[model samples]
Target: TVQALLRESDNYIPQVEKIKYEVGNGTFVDDGGIYIRWINDIVRYGMYASKTFQRRDILGVYSGLVTRQLTDLEYAWEFNYLVDVKDEEDKKIRVCIDAKHMGNYMRFANHRDTNQNGDQLYVVYNDLWHVLYIAQAEIKLHEQIFVNYGQGYWENKKKYDF
Candidate 1:
């Protein structure tokens, strides 16, 4: 049975916990809920759902400890993973996540429909001072999650074929 989450209005804020740990080579949130695999040669790391989540649900929170605060956006995109958000000092910041060696389940989310999964995951820089991943649509069990890859990723891509 589904449990109803009550809120005063659509803007109701829920308490979200931050869990930071290794994703691929370990378990997190649940007992190893997410896994990485591929049938053959693929684009790269793929994050699959081990559990189902309702639409507008809080899927996961990006709680990686290691972050980079770049003075400019030019060198920030050089890293493989990154998110632009406001830090504790109330300043615009870009978080460069090095998921190649260390990361969590949230890193598996694709950008610019790179995984051909559309936009299943959404990046929300919450007012509670954290970046959380919300479900863009109803996420079924065992399905792959995706987030809107920033504009820079779509500049060269032709059409929304992916």
Candidate 2:
């Protein structure tokens, strides 16, 4: 459904073309191992923003946590490091979007983790700006992690009613 909406959007062509060019030039990976490709393209083309950070690095951190590859000691160490590195003053990051103007179709959900913790996430159909912004912000925790891969985050075994 999201793919279909994207295909229907006039802006989708240029965005996809830019992604193809980037992948072809080796500036971006084409293997589809990470959803960051789609996110980055959204930010770069859809939002008209410059590349502010490396998506791959951020994803590596998420992979470590999600896969339980980080040992207790490692996790503690990283947690401390992150706390120390976090902004001490005015630690808010703001994202402003005119949804109506953008003409974006977005969806949200909630579900439960394997451990039964509640998580909430969102999705956008054809709106690269919203999709990528949410993804990047979630990856950095500048905003909450609202999406997991292509699926919505789960909370309490029940998906959020959109």
Best by TM-score: 1
Clashes of each: 1, 10
Against the hidden reference, what TM-scores do the models get?
0.53, 0.23
Candidate 1 wrongly placed segments (more than 4 Å): 1-14, 17-33, 69-98, 113-128, 154-162
- lDDT by residue (13-51, candidate 2, tens digit) is 444456547857889653322221133322221111122
Q: Write the per-residue lDDT of candidate 1 for residues 94-116, one digit (tens) a residue.
A: 55634444446676666554433
Model 2: which ten-residue window has the lowest total lDDT?
A: 74-83
TM-score of model number 1: 0.53
> Would you list the C-alpha lDDT of every candidate in the order shown?
0.50, 0.27
Residue pairs in clash, model 2: 110-160, 111-154, 111-155, 112-154, 112-155, 112-157, 118-155, 119-154, 119-155, 121-146
